[model samples]
Target: MDLDCFKAYDIRGKVPEQLNPELAERIGRSYVEVTGARKVIVGYDIRLSSPEIAAALSEGLRTAGANVFDIGQCGTEQVYFATSHFGMDGGIMVTASHNPKDYNGMKMVGPDARPISSTNGLLAIREGCREPLGNARQPGELFQIDAMKPYIEHLLGYIDIDTLTPLNIVVNPGNGGAGEVIDALEPYLPFEFHRVHHTPDGNFPNGVPNPLLPENRTPTSMAVTASNAAMGIAWDGDFDRCFFFDEKGRFIEGYYIVGLLADQFLRKTGGGKVIHDPRLTWNTRELVQEAGGEPIESKTGHAFIKERMRDEDAIYGGEMSAHHYFRDFAYCDSGMIPWLLVAERLCQSGVSLSSLIDARIETFPASGEINRTVKDPEHILQGIERRYLEEALSVTHTDGLSMEFQRWRFNLRMSNTEPVIRLNVESRGDIELMKSFTRSLLDDIEELDGQSLRDPQLSVAL
Candidate 1:
């Protein structure tokens, strides 16, 4: 077994190469040994390779003396739901979340949907999988279950929509498993929906369903504009992250959605602690505080945020990456909840999504997020830290490297799963200053590479 398959967060790789039946079977046995769980729930996405991988994994689990509850063909959230809903000891979701079609991976959750990351139990699983210690003493049982309908019902319980006003809405499932869930929920939903690429085509004819990419969002934005819809939503591969487009067909930053959801949760929960990623706007912090709740910041990534939420007992946690986690939902992120709340908020306020986010935009201007490919991401990050961060700002390395100024802050960190360094800059309603600072930093980065940098202002305008 290749150790490289075990990523910083989950077990992921190219299908049949890095991820195959043999490797999945080994991981199954390893998971049983690491967690010492008798029964594990297994789920997978709509990818072409998912069925085979799920079977292989279950085979390994049964071989390791663990009964497997196979929840066939579902999103990552469904696996999380099943793990907690059925009181299973652990769960595994075979997916490649937002990655291209050629890739697939597994996300593991312990009891209560708590994630097992590299630093926690994933390393042990990796090491154990590398060396198989034979099969189980006896064959374990394998059973099948349909968790999607129940999962949809559970999501619907989070929001009240009895009197939701009908409005034109657009949804792009991006050819992922979300299409099936959306198909089931649309009839029950109170809206005129315009769907694009909603079909579950494993070929992903429309393109990869990752709305994080500017190119991937083009279809959703165009559809929203053409249909004159009130709002538009797009989901990633496993339906864990959802991206939004306003009525104007402009992509809304996930930070604003975080603040919106935080407000909604706070309204219902009577002001508790809210956990958020350190990447984007402090508007979420302000919103939480204004709602009489404590605001806590965590490192970027779902695992870290979920762990922090559990520790702080946060009512909810959100990241600018569009991953929203709820304490009521076993501290697991759900792509379904964010859009549901958006609809409810729109209905309650009788306002458009643009109108709702416009007020916050005035107070909290941001540069969105920027990803730059560099020869050495670390050297560029160190350069920025030594020159800009160490001298004038409060610095921290909770995720990669984050620095806060008096009124503006930015996080520059190499991606744990990719080679590029991700940059997120936010300012206090100063778009000009944000552009200047971003350009200056990019200029610094380009200087290190001896290449003339492009217009940073232009890069951010989009």
Candidate 2:
């Protein structure tokens, strides 16, 4: 009865101990009981324990009188796509998403593919699992579905295929679920793909498929240079987030990609609201404004971004963490759409990815996201705020403490699940200024760490 798997956003934990087929089945039933979903879409990733867990979950769904559409072995987004594409009542994806091989978990969404987080019915579902429900009057049926075709077609609709010219592109799925998708889209596209670790392996031969790590990015970067590909793209285990590399084999920061995507989406939508996170703003805001699109800032995280997108009717939303949301795709983030749009832009503009991103990087130099482990994250956050609040031109608490000044800005936010605080600093086209402030902030954080230990009573309201 260990329900530690239930998280702020989704369920994720060590397998068998924290999560297993039994709990998964109970969760499936609980999902139906909480949401009253009569027709549910069930999908799983390429994890070793996924098939058995998914089958058990489907059984639980059936027991709860909810019919199950099993889209076997797909990415997390596929569940989102299948759920909304076929108008299912809800969907659940059995995936830990870049977690260790020994771990397994689930991501759930209610009607219209809206996420079922703790703020919604996730906690209620967790509670429901504690007390099992009796068998329903009638068990529901199970249907195996091939959502690949319609899903791929829907993805292709984002960009004009006719406009895409033959270009050499490097794609590294890192032995995750994205290779299957790339293979499916191969016949319809004009690009010559240099696929690295293209096979979908539950063992994750190349690693856990998290391209965000500096070590995991090496293979993709090398492949881009070795093959002289136009650009390189790498995805996480579930492929909900995708990281990019330029022709020169350099990893492009996700913040820059956010701006690039905002501009691209705005051009297509002919001036629509584009939502971005608060961490890095100058580049995205400037690009969005230049493209005649309204740039709206939302608190970081997929749920927050999607909800804001729904509220504002945004054409697109992006995070510096690599999740890109689209209005056409039911306000869900897609790993496929972002890359395709970038490739299309490359083809149309006849420019290298580096050329496009370099300009933006120069216009807005950022320190990227730097994480620091501290004794007291809250105290450090408050200490930093106290030091900077007096002269700050503007202060925002959308997600974290974001203080903006005349020439620079920084966001110091604590991690939800860890004792680490993440800091992001940026300047108006001044790399030295950005670097100087980043170092200064790091020093302040280091000093605050000691100060907090000495004076625990030093409290400042957020």
Candidate 3:
């Protein structure tokens, strides 16, 4: 078995080459063998290849003597819901999640919807699937079912229905699986949705549903401005993570959303614990402290965050990449819950989204995540650290290498799932300083990438 498709968190790869039905089936058997899960729930997203892969996975699971619940065409979060809500031993979601057309992947969770990742279990599954030594047992039962209505009701529970105000909002599912849930929640809420790319088109006529890209965000931004919405929200293909834009059509960084949400939850819960990733930390830490909440720092992946949240009995957990987790929700991340909480915050505060985040923006300016394909990411990271170490105030490797200076700090790390390095820079109440250092860093990266260094500040997109 060629295990090139197995990643740190999930199994993702290009179709036919890296992922196919045979591999998925073998993986399904491996999952049951490795986890000893007798009951499994399976789902797929709005990808052309997802259905076939899911079918094969379910077949393999059943053949391995595990009963399977076939919840067709749902978001990754729905699998989390089914796994924990029904008390199943395991769950699998077939999705590439913002990857290009030829790509597909799967996310798995053990009992209680807790994540299964490389640090804990993924690599072991990879090893188990090779050679398929498990003898065939009597096939287990497979049942078809729908988990949407229950999932939507759970989402509504995150916000009080009576407290919501009538506000127009722009919603872009990007032709992914989120449109279904949004439509289901419409009749129960007072908000009018300006829906775009609302249908689940597997071919993705509007391109893959990744709102993190600057190009992918323009549609949502324009829709917000044109519709005069209170805010705009966009989700990835699997709808596991969601992005935000204010009424003025300005994109809000996911890092600040972490702080904003921490403020809202902390105020309501009256000083509980909140877990945050180590990527862009200053704001989240300060916001949690100011709101009288304890901020716990965790490593920058779902598995790590979930583990830390469970250890601390945290009320909530957030990552700068838009993944939000709730203790009430089995410590699994949700794309739906975060936005609902934000909407409730807007309603209660009676303030525009831009105004709500303006002060925080000015107080902690940041360069949004920038990615560059590099030949040797390790070399560049080492070089950057060597150049900045002399003047650094503190250095930490909570997730990646994070170096803090007097006025500014940045994190440079390799993506666990992609062939690129991600860079994030921020300054304490100084946008110019952030901009200048960001430029300097990017220039260094370009030179390290073996390309002729052009000016990194050609335009200030952030």
Candidate 4:
């Protein structure tokens, strides 16, 4: 009866107490009722509870007269791929991506693999799940599907394979689902892979799979340097987001990767719209324009970016959080496609990954993302906005409070699920200025809140 598992974008919470097989079944039946999806694609991640949860969910869908195409033990994007690729009416991926191992949840998408968030049918499904179940209709058929082959082929379509020469790359899945995908694609590529924590382990023996954490990056970074690899990549649990490291074992901030990917996508498409988050913009905007593509800014989050990409028919969309969305992949984010394209660029340009990113870093320096747990996020945000409103050359609220001055800019936003404030600062060809503004902003925030701030953690080095 406890349906607290439903969240703004997806269902995520502790197992059993917050989410269980019984509740999952109800959700499955409710999904069919709310969206009227006749045929649905179902998949799950590497969590231990995933298989049972997925099976119960399929039973509910079948009882509701919806045929279920089950893609077993896959990442979230695989469900997205299968749904849209097979022309299914909807899709559901059982995953608590990057969450603690004790938790399990689901991400759902409607027809064409469009996300179903609170604004759409998520709320309705939650409400429907609370009511008593009706008599079962004629049960629909269930079919096992192997979606990996076509999905892998679709990923290969992103770049010219013949252009890719042999190179060494380090891939750390962090004991998540990405290793399986890399294994599936290994034979088709020319690169030699040095894998770290490459198995699919639900226990997450090497800590949780989030590569965003500073500590989690050490293994991948060390391997890249020790093996003399050209580049390194890491993905979170369920592999929805991926992070990169250059030849020098230096972590490349996701902000820079957005710009790099935009440039690559634009070059291939000749010219198309590229959607980017507003948190860090100068680098992406400049590269997009130079590549003869329009740079469209969207509010942060996968749902908003995907919706914007659909509206604009964008060739690609990227968030500095490492979620890269491709127009061809049902506008869903993929951990696999990004590294492949980056590798292809490496081969074609004959330049190191660091070389490709260094110029961009110098042109537009950023503070990356700094997270601070504030006593009052709204008060802090409003106070900062009031102080900066006068001197600001421009202010935008695409996602949060973004103010631009003559030479530098900063964005301050509150976290959706916590009382944490995220800050990002950037300057036009000035790293020192960016650093200075970042320090000043933190000082201002603490002074306004009248509380000593916690030691802020930077998601990436300046």
lDDT (10s digit) by residue, model 2, range 187-255: 999999999999989898778889888999999999999999999999999999999999999999999
Better model by lDDT, 2 or 3? 2
| lDDT of every predicted structure (CA atoms) | 0.86, 0.93, 0.90, 0.93
| Candidate 4 local lDDT, 1-462, one digit each (tens) | 788899999999899889998998899899999999989999999999999999999988988889999999999999999999999999999999999999999999999999999999999999999988664558889999999999999999998999999999999999999999999899999989999999999999999999999999999999999999999999999998999999999999999999999999999999999999989998899999999999999999999999999999999999999999999999999999999999999999999999999998998999989999887787787778878899999999888899999999999999999989999999999899999989999998878666324322221110
Instruction: State which candidate has the highest TM-score.
Output: 2
Per-residue lDDT of model 3, residues 177-268, tens digit only: 99999989999999999999999999999988999888999999999999999999999998999999999999999999999999998988
Which has the higher lDDT value, candidate number 1 or candidate number 4?
4
Report how far residue 366 has shifted in candidate 3, in Å: 0.9
Where is model 3 poorest over a 10-residue stretch in terms of lDDT? 453-462
Pick by lDDT: which candidate is best? 2
Error of 2 at 96 (Å): 0.7
Better of 1 and 3 by lDDT: 3
Candidate 4 residues lying further than 4 Å off, grouped into runs, are: 451-462
Cα RMSDs, all models = 4.6, 1.1, 4.7, 4.2
Task: Give, for candidate 1, the lowest lDDT window spanning 10 residues.
Answer: 451-460
Per-residue error for 450 in candidate 3, Å, reads: 7.2
Worst 10 residues of 2 by lDDT: 453-462
